[model samples]
Each structure stands twice: as C-alpha cells, then as structure tokens.
Target: MTLTLYSNYVNSAGERVRIALALKGIDYEYVSVGEISWEVYERINPQRLMPALKIGDQIVPQATAILEYLEETYPKPALLPADPVLRAQARAFAQHVVSEMHAIDVIRVRRFLHNQLGVDQEGIDHWQNHWFANGFAALEELLARRQTAWTFCFGETPGWADLHLTPQVTKGIARFNVDMAPYPLISGIHKACVTLPAFIAATPAEQPDYPGRVIEPKLR
Candidate 1:
C-alpha cells in the first residue's frame, strides 16, 4: 500500500503523525506541502492543515484521526498500549498534547496573534512561552504521577504520548525558548527519544522542506 503523507517542517501535528509512521516501521511517500497557501492545502485537507495522509484512494485528514487509522491498520509493534486502561490513558495524554498543548503553538496561531490581535513579536514569544510551559508542567506531573522511572511517557518504550511529545518539546525548545528545567521527566524522555532511530528520522530537521535551525536540546 502506498502511504502518501502531505506534510511540512514546523507543523507539529504533521510531525506527530510522522513519529507514529516511523514507530510502526511504515515506509511512505513524503510529499512536501510546505510553502503552500491555505487555499492549496485546503485541497488536500479542508481544514487547511499540514500532514494529510492518503491511504490508497481515501484521504485521511487530522493528526489524531490519521494516527488512529494507522494504529488500527498497522497492528503489530503497536503505538498504543495493550491493556485497555493504559490505552485510554495513552490516548488521553497524546490527544491532550496534540489538541490542547499543540493546537495553539502553531505558525498560523502566532500569525493570528500578531496580525489579528496586534501582538508584537515579544508578545507572541510570551504567548508561546506561557502556554508551552503550562503544557509541559501538566505533562511533567502526569509522567511523574504514574511511574517511578520511565524512559518515555506512560512507559519505558516509546508509544502514543511520546509521539506527540517528542515533536512538541523539540519544537518548543527550539522555537519558543521553552525551559526544560521545570520538566525533568519530559526532558529526560525527549533525550531518550532522540537517541532512537525512528524518533530521530521523524523529526522536523529530517523533513525535506526544513529551513529552520535544528534543535538538539542539552540533556543536562
């Protein structure tokens, strides 16, 4: 089956799906939709979003939906946990990161903040920093709540939560000037994730249309 993903660098939602695709060892056609206008992207995804996955003749839009589709289709080496409760927990964590934390931390949103709301660059930076720190704080507490020690969120192995996390955290530190000091658990998991080949391959820097500086956060 030909899995064609329409994506771009700096699209956190797209990056989330990329991590899942890599984790499942799925080889896909990377079609660069970067630098496309909203009108153009709307042809692939009506929502005007990046990372629309085409499965055969059917098109799958939205990161969360695409992920669930992939998880169902690619069952082996599961991205979600086996146990039902753990699976729900993982979904909750991943969804929260994608929908809540990551939703506002996008380029368009920043553009909205600046162009529409009359916020300055410093204000935009402050806006991003505030929300990212809030998201990281919640994730830190969640990671600390469940386990004594885990290399990834929800477990030792990289799974659902890690998929959303690695992208968001990496982008956060790189672009938003997010501090990792308050999120030791999250920071540690990110460090461990970047070491893995799949996670590394799925990063924004590894994308074809990457034009920004790459982030390799200090694990110290």
Candidate 2:
C-alpha cells in the first residue's frame, strides 16, 4: 500500500495522524499541502480538510477517522486501550479534543471571525483562549480523577489520547503562550509527549513546510 499524508506542518489534526503513523512504525510519504490551492486539494478531499491519508487509491479524510483506520489496520501497538470500558473512556477524550475543543477553535473558525465577522486579533485571541481554557480545565479534572496513570494519558505507552493531546497543548503554548501552570497534569503530559521519537518527528519544526511562524493552518 502506498500511504501518502497530505497536510500542512502546523495543522494539529495532521500532526496527530503523523504521530500515529510514527507510533505504528508505518513508513509513508508526507506531502506538505501548505501551498496548494483549495481547488486542487478538494479533488483529493471533498471536505477540503488537511491530513487526508491516501492508501493506494482511496482517500481517507478527517483525522479521527484516519486514526481509527490506522488502529484497525495496524493493531500491534494499539492506540486505544484493550478493555472495553477503558476504550470508551479513551475515545471520549479524543472526541472532546477533536470535536469540542478543535472544531470550535480551529484556524478556519478564526479566519471566519476575522474575514467575515470583522473580529480583530485581540478579540480572536480572547475568543481562542476562552475556549481553550474551558477544554483544558475539563481535561485537567479528568486527569486528576485518575487513580493510576502513566507517562501518557491512558497508559505508560503513547495512545490516541496522547496523540490528540500533545499537539493541542504544545501548539497552544508555543503560538498563543497559553498558561499551562494552572493545569499541571495536562502540562506534564505535553512536556513528556514531546520527548518521544514519534512526537519529535511530527512536530511543526521537523516538517518540510515549516516556515518559521505559522499563523494559518494552511489547509489548502
């Protein structure tokens, strides 16, 4: 199978899939779509989203779905817990990260606020920070409730939860200067995750299209 990942460097969703591929030890081609036109990318992905995985001839869009496909296809180092209840718990965390946290505060939404709604940078910053804080606060509480925890959120080894988390937390800190001192558990997990080989490889600085400061997600 020819696995090609089409995404920009700064995209969190793309970064998650990249991290997952590295964890699974799957060698695939990385195509930086930072400069492509929407018309061109739409041909590959109908939704015109980033991190679409092309396996042979089929194109799989959406980071969550791509992660699921990878987990089912490459089941050795499981990205989810083996226990049914624990698996549901892990999925719940991922769902929050992807849907509640990301869907609301992604670059596209920010762009719409700026371009269409005439929201200034200060307003956008306040908007983004507000939503991020809400999400992180909930996650911190969840982590605090854990009786037994490992380096990652779900276990000692990195899982899908960690993949979703590392990018969001790291990006929030790196770009927006998010104050992590409040959430010790979330902050610690982000710090630990970056040290791993997979996350190190998937970071924005390591990507081919990383051009210093990346404001937009470049979901071309």
Candidate 3:
C-alpha cells in the first residue's frame, strides 16, 4: 500500500508527520495543499486539518495520533521506548506543547506583516513573550528532571515528544523571537534533534511554500 501524506508545505503538524516518516525511513508521497485546501481536506477529515495520513485503506488525522500510528506500524529503530512509564512521559511532553503552549503559531508574524490584529506593538510583544515564557517554564522543569541517557525528551531516543517539540522550537525562535538560553535542557534537546537526519529532513525551510522571501529577513 502507498502512504500518502496530505498536508500543507509549511504546517507545524504536517512537519511532525514528515519527521516520523523520515525517522522510520519510509517511502511516501508528499501532496502539498494550499491554505484554502481546507475546503478539500474537509472531505477527508471533518476537522479539516492538515497532516492527515492515508495509509493503505486507513485515514489518520491529528498530528500526535499520526506519529503514534507510524511508530506502531513501522517499529524499526523504535521512536517510543519499550518501558511504559517512559513512553507516558514522552507523550506528556508532546501534549504539553500541543495543548499547553500558547502563541506557538505565526500569529505575531502575521500581525507584524499586516498590523491588523487591533492590538498595539506593546500588546503584541507581551502576548508573544507571555506564552513563550509560560510554555518554556513547564518545558524546563520537565527536562531538568528527566532521567535519560540521550538527553532526549524520553529515554535514550528521539521519540514522539521530541519530534513534536523541535519544530515548535523553530517557530518560537524564528517567528516569536524566543530565546533558548533560559531553557538549557530544551536547548540541548533541540540541538540534539537537529543532528538527527529525521529532524533535519523535516525542517520548515525545506518545505515548498515556506514564505522564502517574506519571513527570510525576520528569520535572521
């Protein structure tokens, strides 16, 4: 059966799936959809979200679910550890970002570009920093107490939690001007993540509609 990932080129969740695919070294077809592609995605997923995976005859939605599916179906270099507690920890970390973290998307970037969020610059700055500080505070605590050898989110490997985090780190830094110097463990984990081929292969810049010129200046 052919594995087809239907996603937008610059989506965070979509990027997660891409990393999982790369980590498992699985061959799949990439179908890039536009912002308005939600109209079509609604047919596939009632939620109308990206990063939907079509494997054989099954359709999987939700980013974290897709990652778990990938791990269960193709368990080679195992992303999730064998120990149940460790796996739970990893899943918790992933959930923290996907659920607890705020100001994680390109809201600030869009506001900067259009200046149309009805808020002043000071308000925008406060909103952005507020979320990063709150989220990283939780992340820092998790990493500081982690009992692992590889300095990953979970045991000794880059599991689902680590995969969910790396891209958000990029978004926090490039898009929200998040400084990682405060979160040493997160910084270390992100550093380790980039060294892996799967994480490298799933970078947003490598995607097709990556706002090459628009966000390039701000990225630096």
Candidate 4:
C-alpha cells in the first residue's frame, strides 16, 4: 500500500497521525504542507489542513479520522483496546487532547487572535496556557483515578491517548510556555512516552521541515 501523508512539522494533529503510523511500523511518503502553497494544499484538502493521509486513491482528512482509518486498516499492534469500556476511556482521553486542548491552540486560531481579533501577544499566550492547564489537570486526574500499572495512559503499551498527549505536552513545553510542574502525572507520562522510539521518531524536531527553529518559554 502506498501511503502518502501531507503534514506540517509543528502541528500536533499531524504528529498524532505520524506517531500512529510509526507505532504500526508503516512507511509512507511524507509531504510537508508548510513548504507548499495554500492553493496547492487546498487541492489536497478543501479545508487546507495539515496531516491528510492519502491511501491508494482515497484521501483521509482530519487527524482523528486518519487515525481511525489506520487502526481499521492495520489491526495488529492495535492503538485502541479491544474492550468496549476501555476503548471509550481511551477515546475520551484522546479527545481531551485533540478536541479540547489542541483545537484551541492551532496556528490558525492563534493567528486569528493576533491578526483579526487584535489580541496582544500576552493575551494569546494566556489563552494557550489556560486551555492547556485545564486539559492537563483533567487528564492528570483521569490517570490518577485509573491507577494503571502501565506507564502509559491506558496500559503498559502506548496507544491512542499516549500519542495525543505526548505531542500536546511537547507543544506545551516547546511553544506555549505552560508550566508543567503542577501536573506531575502528565509530566511523568510525557517523560515516559518520549523514551519510546515511536514518540521520538514522530517529534516535530525530528521532521524534515523543522527549520532549525526554537521557541523559548515566555512565562515558565
């Protein structure tokens, strides 16, 4: 199967899909949308979003959707649990990061706040930090409650939730200047995830179009 991935290195959503593909031991042609024109990207995705997966003749847009397609297509080394309740728990954890936290911090939203809404840099930073803290706090509580023996979010092996959490934590530390000290569980989980080969390989800095750029924390 010829799998082509259109993605931006800095995007958490794209990172999620990339980690999934890596864990599945799948290889594909990676195209960096950051290097392409908007017009070209719009042709690939009407929304012009990063991380669209092209499988054969079919195009899968949206990171969550792409992940689902990958899980369905590659059943071995499953990213989701077989049990229904555990699966729902894992999906809830993934959604907390992807839908709740990541959605608010996307580049488009930050640009809109700065350019269109005329929000100052401080205001934008506050916006990002607030949402990140709220999400991480909830996740910390969730993991604490579950009390799983495994180091990952759900079990011993990393899965859907770990993939989502790792990138968001990476963005939090690398971009938003969010203080991770308060969320020990999240910090610990993130530390554990990064040690894995899949997470390390899927990091933004490891991407081809990373631009050798770095963002120092403004508040933390």
- Alpha-carbon RMSD of each model: 4.4, 2.0, 3.9, 2.8
Per-residue lDDT of candidate 4, residues 1-220 (tens digit): 7999999777779999999999999999888886886789899889778789999977889999999999999987999987888899999999998888888887778888888888898898789888998999999888888846468888878999999999999888877678999888888889999999999889888889887885432221
Q: Rank the candidates by lDDT, best first.
A: 2, 4, 1, 3
- The superposed Cα distance between candidate 2 and the true structure at residue 90, in angstroms, equals 0.9
Ten-residue stretch with the least lDDT total in model 3: 211-220
- Give the local distance difference test score of model 2: 0.88
Query: Tens digits of per-residue lDDT for model 3 on 34-84?
Result: 644767778877766677888887788888888888888898878877889
Off by over 4 Å in 4: 214-220
Residue 92, candidate 4: how far off, in angstroms?
0.4
Ranking by TM-score: 2, 4, 1, 3
The best candidate by lDDT is 2
Candidate with more favorable, higher lDDT: 2 or 3: 2
TM-score of each: 0.91, 0.94, 0.84, 0.94
Give lDDT tens digits, candidate 1, residues 1-220: 8999988766778888888888888999988774566667788778767779999987988989999899899987888888888788888888778877778776778777788888887897788888888888888888878844766777768999898888888887876678899889889999999899888788878888876665432212
Show the lowest summed lDDT stretch of 10 residues, model 2.
211-220
Better of 3 and 4 by TM-score: 4
| Local distance difference test, each candidate | 0.82, 0.88, 0.76, 0.86
Scanning candidate 1 in windows of ten residues, the lowest lDDT window is 211-220
Q: Supply candidate 1's per-residue lDDT for 24.
A: 89
